[model samples]
Target: MKRREALEKKKSIEELIKNANDPLKDHLNSLPCSYRHYNRNGLSVYLESGIGSNLSSFKKQYIQKLLKVNMEAAYGPKEWVFEEKVKRKEMVAPDARYVFVREIVDNEDGMQPPGDSFVGFLQYRFVLEEEMPVAYVYELQLEQCVQGKGLGKFLMQLVERIAYEYRMSAVMLTVQKGNVFAMDFYVSQLRFVVSSNSPSRMGFNTSYEILYKAVDCEAKEK
Candidate 1:
């Protein structure tokens, strides 16, 4: 679908909110997959379950479902987008890891879902890109109601933080050029640079752009 048409049909799920819900992380602790926490820019979030290769069947299905929901919500009826690839990677890739993100509710003084409330999720793995190890973000999707909030930045920060923690050189991700919103979000908002090896950059008319942020060594030096 064209970018203009996609923007026209776009609707935020926040329209369904009956009461005010802050799109930031909750203040609870010790939830499932809670590996790290962040308080940058007055926004808080947690890293849960640094699972490797052995993601449960239930989690795999849920991630696929969420991915489909996000894709359809963005570009209309993307029924064939995310499933087989997610399954194959999550079930077998030795370096694959899942990072589930949740929005915390301060009023309840507890987590929203199994650990915290489920607002969004991310999947990534360590891989060699251009002869250097980097954390590659396979997917990052958040609920519509939480879109404009700072949570997306927080999640990307998590990916970079993980990369630095593991001594990886950077964090990489793929975004469709047709996805104007995401392209802007990643480039303008998150400050990711397109890789020189990306398809379009290499003169091929491609659907996506490979973007990366240098982390680890550079991050630690400063």
Candidate 2:
């Protein structure tokens, strides 16, 4: 009964945060504005944050295409189903938040750059998971051109910081067993562990596993 009450309190906390006009603003204010700009490995890019519903049509299409391509490559065409996996409603749900990485383009004329400049994006939401408040990563997709430049780790670290600031218990995400690179990145490099609620642990023969990193010491102990 005490555990149930605690879980309810956590859910309420998450709802309050998600209902804010700018959920990430307070958590991000302490960071320098330049933190959004990435310049390394001869690659320059900028980051922007917004709720999924705010994504422009161009950006929406870009995200769908990028996610489709990446998932297909990982799962193969035989396992890929567009409607089942790439649902637009889920991607653009009001509660879904995004951190977009766009290439830096020079326009001395002071006009917006032509065409899409997006290179990658991370989508996440604050929710109750395993009776704990958690930041759940729905997707992290990057263009092939920008892969292996440490951007993925940088983005995830940002997510962890934000989650910590928001008092979330942990950062959680799902990874497909077929995506060996991603599994290694999360498990080996980032040190995320398989969650106790993962399908494999529950005796379910699923193709994917749920992994998480505890953000709070209390959560780690639990």
Candidate 3:
């Protein structure tokens, strides 16, 4: 009787676990989209987009799912509870990092808005050495709605434009094969040169490609 009872209990727990996963899967599939626009004057910059309060929740859920374990399993029981607080600390509004809402201008007047607005953005990190400036795009995100509308290309070109103004010697970025659309865009549309020699540190196992566009920003003007 004891053995039979234990088997029934195990079956009930399995059913519960399966049922709980369905809703979470659906939530991820239908994540919401919030778009904005941005611009920086002359200097290369990181553009943040996709802002909303739910960004925190999204990150927590994403980390949980990626581990494929409940919070307790991932961080251990007591540790997990405390770790939740740390996770909240790491939370950022999706758009806070990339939005340039301050640049928007009101149609009623020539005045710019108090902050920049971005529909999507590419984040360029520029490093200056001596007289040379090299910029790398650490992140790029397209508003889900604005994606597939050529906004990605427009945003990328905007980065190069900023690099030109900053007198950057070169601009570069990396794209993994899983994101084939981005790879194609960088190679074909922007005319970025793909590096054949070195593998990427982060995506070593994947078909990650590094690309760069050299700018003779210091070249003497004729």
Candidate 4:
């Protein structure tokens, strides 16, 4: 409990990212250096770490746009309004952390690319679930162009790796039941199971389901 509390109180997850020997860092380094593009040799895609509170205005807008584009349908009109407001508040929370997938132009000058280069992002935070320390993924939004390319799976894998590195009990996320693709991807492909704290498990009817992948059994036991 003490260890979990300490981790929850941490201001940043950068220590793990900066550790030279951390497997999470190694895994990130092993991703494809370039994504194939039509004109250039290849567009470079890289992961960047950020805190929600520190996000630039442009990035904040981009995140909002991505969330709306990807989730509005699943949430529907009535629910979307409330959900959007909630998500906007969550996005700027002090503890929220992000892993952004960004594309770089294949140019000699290495200038900042246009907003379209922002492919996707994963937002998460450390929290206690059922008295156990866990990493809760609030959002994982990918652009349509990047869909079906295994990037979502890769991001989830990174989340699990991060959880293991931090000795978290599990990596948890919520998915709307209406989103069949997301449901299949997480439950079937990623092997996430319905969490005990989920509304369904508790005999409640809800639009979303909570799912989790246990990362450290020993940590959970402790």
Candidate 5:
């Protein structure tokens, strides 16, 4: 009986080791890092820090401004921005696109989604004042210093995987047509198709193009 008990303990320890070796499990064990809960005032503050003199170009310029700030801060630590003082000129008119933090949840169909379960981070969405599918991510940011650590791609994949699980036709966003880095990243790396002839929305005249990735692809082996 003592021998059997020792074997059971060994088995439990082996199971733990196996779980610890999993990449996702390892990340979760190490995470909840660099997350913030930005409310309206907080979101406003976060945006103001990045973009100056917000104009009402787009209906929800505030949300777009936030995305711009988050993106720039995450990826834009160049000398030219400071030297040329181009940061001030980058501000857009304030509009109604807002951000929120709800929760990250795995759907019944086995897709992980943020903002549905309680992850305590900001999620920016562009929604018309009168629309049903109001939750649309214009741009997603995972903090500046932590950008290249694979977490950004992981979070995006999480969103894509969840959207696919729910049978979403496509996931969409507008990109600054001149943002070659963003265009290349989405179009080449992630396989999103660019819409060549989409109608431009009001006040969003800064070289915008609609891009989308199909969510319903054949399941790949895990």
Candidate 6:
């Protein structure tokens, strides 16, 4: 896309997001069905989204298992896994307005329960931090069975589009330093830069890197 066209497109999407009924509502409308399917390494994988507050107990359990399985190698302590979910339950409440993503598998006829075949999830929120609004990614995880198939990139593109549409100048996330693949994926493929205030840059030398990709020139480096 040309620079001028891209800027106009972002402006148009921003207007839609600002005028829509809910926060960034047009972004979801653009998606229509909460579900979409794509081919990954010849396997059809479905990605779906919904109001986080609407997730059922079973769905929550599915998220728990997927997160534990996908992240335990990097995060450690299965008990912390459970604890994190406990805190997440608070995040998914209605007013927090989180958008949740889950991967579903299709049956022979393409019909299945929403909670039955969940392979993973991504949780996100749009809000002002330090006086700047940004699309903050809380979590993005996929089952080991279907990972490394470009699905993460697919989902991230969706997130970036939404961020741009919502007029957020930056798309921000945190990556564990131990997760080398994730680091390379964000920095190399997605072109994310480490924020000036990131843990390592600030001398905390933490295990996490706060990364962001500027959607426009006005985006803060931090």
How close is every model to the real structure, measured as TM-score?
0.68, 0.87, 0.45, 0.78, 0.39, 0.76
Worst 10 residues of 1 by lDDT: 13-22
Residue 149 lDDT, candidate 4, scale 0-100: 76
Which regions in candidate 6 have their CA more than 4 angstroms from the true location? 1-26, 31-35, 78-87, 95-115, 220-222
TM-score of candidate 4 against the unseen true structure: 0.78
* Model 5 C-alpha lDDT per residue in residues 1-222, reported as the tens digit of each score: 999987785565444433433323222223332322222311211111111233335423434444456555434558435622443333232321222333333468653333222221223222321111112344454444334544444445544543343333355666767678767877887776654334453334555677666544421110
For each candidate, the alpha-carbon lDDT, in order, equals 0.63, 0.82, 0.48, 0.75, 0.40, 0.68
C-alpha root-mean-square deviation, each candidate: 15.2, 2.9, 21.2, 6.2, 19.8, 6.6
lDDT (tens digit, per residue) of candidate 6 on 17-61? 344326435355466353266566754555655556676788677
lDDT of 6: 0.68
Question: Which scores better on TM-score, 4 or 6?
Answer: 4
lDDT of 3 by residue, 7-39 (tens): 785565444333322322321123222122323
* Candidate 5 Cα deviation (angstroms), residue 197: 5.1
State the local distance difference test value for candidate 1: 0.63
Error of 6 at 90 (Å): 5.3
lDDT of 1 at 99: 69
Clashing pairs in 4: none
- How many clashes in each structure? 6, 0, 18, 0, 19, 0
Q: Locate the minimum summed-lDDT window of 10 residues in model 2.
A: 19-28
Best by TM-score: 2
